[model samples]
Target chain A: AQSVTQLDSQVPVFEEAPVELRCNYSSSVSVYLFWYVQYPNQGLQLLLKYLSGSTLVKGINGFEAEFNKSQTSFHLRKPSVHISDTAEYFCAVSPRAGAGTALIFGKGTTLSVSS
Target chain B: DTGVTQSPTHLIKTRGQQVTLRCSPISGHKSVSWYQQVLGQGPQFIFQYYEKEERGRGNFPDRFSARQFPNYSSELNVNALLLGDSALYLCASGPGNKDTEAFFGQGTRLTVV
Candidate 1:
């Protein structure tokens, strides 16, 4: 079994300000980490993922995340944010490899970027 | 270029009624997974189907059932609906079982009264 924890439920930031969304996971075996964004009344879109290779992963929209093995964390970060970046972000995890491995997601963090 | 797609964007049902939700996966994708997202909460896994077979199931009750068709499209059936069943049901598609990226649909909002 795998579980994800997102520390913040809401984050407010001004336009052009930097932001970070914290995520931690608990799993007995190797897992794949992913960050997803959901706009108002829309489905989740994959922002980034960490499988095997470098710990630091870059994603679309100038966002990035670092996977820390020791800390069990995969925090998403952006150098600067725009009002269009306001959306709900979710952290998810799944087993490394297997058939029917479903993803388990965290509660979610709502990002509100205001000008 | 089409992503995953779901039907009946919104539905309203009474308690004890039955409901069916549909999903169409992306072209060339063979895996379809179902999830439920309640208000103010993240999505919960419900079922996963691949190659017209059941691949995985979540902690949902037996009242929740689903199946995939020959075309790889799927349908989720829920019996004896309860108010607690009111939630946004999402369908995702992937190329295969171990595929890393899964595309998602807008989801079907099922409201049980």
Candidate 2:
């Protein structure tokens, strides 16, 4: 069994400010990591993923995340954010071996950016 | 290409009643997975079907069942609904390949009263 823990329930930032959302996971086997964004009343959209190589993965909208194997963490980072970036962010994990495996998601972090 | 599509964006059902939710995968996708997202929480995996076969299931009870058709479309059925079942039901599709990610639909919001 695998589980995801998102350390923050909400994050507030001013426009053009930096932000970081923390995520950690516990799985006995190898896994793939992902970050998704959800807007009000909408489904999730993929922001980025860490499948195999390159611990530092960059995503759309100038967002990036670093996969730390030792720390068992994948933290999303953005140097500057806009009001449009205000949305719910979810961290998810899937097993590497099963092509049909289901994704396990974190509780989600609400990112609120004010201008 | 059309992404995953779900039917009846919103539904309301009474206790002990049965409700079915439908999903159509992307043209080339062969796998469909179902999840339930409750308010203020993350999405929970319900079931996954690949190539018309059941591949995985989560911790949900047997009251929840699902199947995939030959065309890779799917239906999730819940029997004896409870208020706890009220949530957003999401359907996702993938190529059934180990190297790719799944695409999601807007989801069907089910309210059980």
Candidate 3:
């Protein structure tokens, strides 16, 4: 089984400032990592995913995440923020060897960006 | 080119009643998965169907059931609805592979009163 933990429940940042959302996971087997963002009253949108190869992966909306195997962490980062970036961010994992690709998600972090 | 689409953007039901939510996957996708997201919480897996077969199930009770049609569309049914059943029901679709990313729908908001 795999589980994700988002360290912060809420993160506040001013517009154009950098922000980071921390995520950690524990899994007995190798797994896939993902970051998703949800706007108000909407479903999740894939920000990025770490499948293999590059540890530093870039995603939409100028967001990126680094996969650290040694730390069992995948933290999301954005160099500059906008008010529109305020939303609920979630970290998720899925077993690479499992037949069902059900995603196990963390509680989520609310990113509130203010101008 | 259509993304995953779910029906009845919002619903209200009384306790002990039954509710059914629908989803249509992207073209050529064969797998559909259901998830429940309570307010301020991440989505929890409910079920997954591939090629009309039940591929995976979460820890939800038997009152929560789902099925996929031959065309790859799916429906999620919840019986004996409770206040806890009121949530945002999300449907995601992928190509039935581990390497691919799943696309999500707009989601159906269920309000059990």
Any residue pairs clashing in model 2, and if so which? none
Candidate 3's error at B101, in angstroms? 1.5
**In order, what lDDT does every prediction score?**
0.95, 0.93, 0.94
Per-prediction TM-score, please? 0.98, 0.97, 0.98
- A33 Cα displacement, candidate 2 (Å): 0.2
lDDT preference between candidates 1 and 2, better one: 1
Q: Residue A83 CA error for candidate 3 (Å)?
A: 1.0
Which runs of model 2 end up more than 4 angstroms from their true locations?
A: B97-100
Writing each residue's lDDT as its tens digit, candidate 3 over A1-115 gives 8899999999999999999999999999999999999999888999999999999999999999999999999999999999999999999999888687789999999999999
Ranking by TM-score: 1, 3, 2
Q: Please list, in the order the candidates appear, how each scores on TM-score for chain B only.
A: 0.97, 0.96, 0.97
Model 3 lDDT at residue B111: 98
**TM-scores for chain A over all candidates:** 0.98, 0.98, 0.99
Candidate 1 chain A has its poorest 10 consecutive residues by lDDT at A94-103
Q: List pairs with backbone clashes in candidate 1.
A: none
